[model samples]
Target: MTSGLLKKNLVCRIILICTFLYLIPPQTIAAELHLALADSTCAPMKEAGLAFTRETGIDLQYSCKSSGLLARGIQAGIIQADFFLSANANWMNSVVDNGLIDRQQVRPLLSNDLIIVTRADSAIKIQKLADLTLPEVTSIIIGEPSRAPFGRYAKQALQKSGLWDELKPKIISKKKISLAVADLAKAEEGTAAILYRTGLADFMRLQFTIPASASEPIEYYAAPLKTMANHKEKAMFLAFIAGDHFNKIFSAVGFSVIHSINRAPEKSVKASH
Candidate 1:
């Protein structure tokens, strides 16, 4: 080929390469959401986090622990969290007292009921809170009130039902609500534990639901800490959590909707400022 023709071919090849490169999609930088959660692994928060990424292109950096531990972290100034979704407001309230988290930015987000659960094989039929007080019933599994909001709410509900005093001494307290539930039928670490639940989805093991009328409704809350420099993004994410996007995911995963009163009295919990 002539020199001029060869040059033209090289130019065409370069153009083709450049065009192909331009057609390739660029890498997207997903924003990081530092979230502190107290629920179980692969639980509601994780499910919602997945959906949040799909909808908003924000990647969640989630840290799941017990609500009590999360609360203690804020109290101890140990956690640097952008968002905090706790099982109860009491912990978030403590964070507010520290003046570290934006109080106006805090709001109730979701709620779960305190259910009474028992082993599926247990012969003792417990339909009411009063049944827990029976002398023959050796033990009852409950969450530790000091840390688990479920446990705290359980105690409060039992107290409201005039049953806490009788049931407190005959109980096995576990740090995590799931741990307590697991202990009801199984023994761990040589400790004779009998776990119980109120309304966990595990229907086969649950003795019977004690009903919301028997206890104060459990409250869940979320607060954006000062760690979020991008307030607009944080607000957007919070709205996604409160709106149908997050709620739908929560509902699909055995979580009763926050506004579902008939199923459970969950306030469509939100705090906007």
Candidate 2:
């Protein structure tokens, strides 16, 4: 967005906040929770919003994208947001590497199992992880590995599962989780895609697995980007996303909240397949 346009959005947000406070009693205006989600297709995030509005008086306004695209936007100074929750840690790290996130403010918010998704009408019966490489699978859609953390996690899982080398050439890479889902939805020709469990939850026909032995459980993180102008609201929203309230929502939507980062040795993680 142009500088003038961005400034207008900020002013509009501020006005909205002020208007909200004025309508609600002073005792009711506890605080504001400004959140920027990776995207709305993420069921955990969508479900959590319903509860967030109930438990906390704080209002949350969020945005979404494939983790890769979000990183590029933040890195390029194009899109400005506060409290960025990503599908993978790599994107969060990239923002941090560029000094966009303060070390103290960043947190590993959640984790999700990766899955191969197909449209509701697919006839090919996929029972195992290796089935993805079959010639019958016309296409494989996924988020851009470099920009989307989930995409990065998906790539890691593929490598760990021994499918990366074979399927790399056939993967239809995208820049947003929702777009990947859209591609899956449009797969009347029976295309396949890899995405977070939450990304595919709305589709009843989609299948997933949590292998006892497989790739490392993809750890995702959230951080306040430097461009986030609202500091207090961002922190409150961050706390809410990591709180027990949000955790329950995440659990219901097939997500695992990592809570906080553990600096100890990385154990043998059976990546949630």
Query: What TM-score, computed on C-alpha atoms, does each candidate reach?
Result: 0.74, 0.72
lDDT of 2 by residue, 200-267 (tens): 64553665563624655476666677777666665556667657887787777777777564332122
The C-alpha stretches of model 2 lying farther than 4 A from their native spots are: 1-33, 40-43, 50-57, 202-204, 207-216, 226-235, 261-273
Regions of candidate 1 where Cα sits further than 4 Å from its true position: 1-27, 40-42, 185-203, 211-215, 254-256, 259-273
**TM-score: model 1 vs. ground truth:** 0.74
Predictions in order: lDDT: 0.65, 0.68
Query: Candidate 2's error at 147, in angstroms?
Result: 2.2
lDDT of 1 by residue, 1-273 (tens): 699999999999999999988887643545677888875433667777887788778788877777888878866868767888777777777787777776666665565555555555555666767777766567766678898777776777778888778876777777876676456547422222222232254433454555666554555667778767877678778677767867777766545546421132123332310
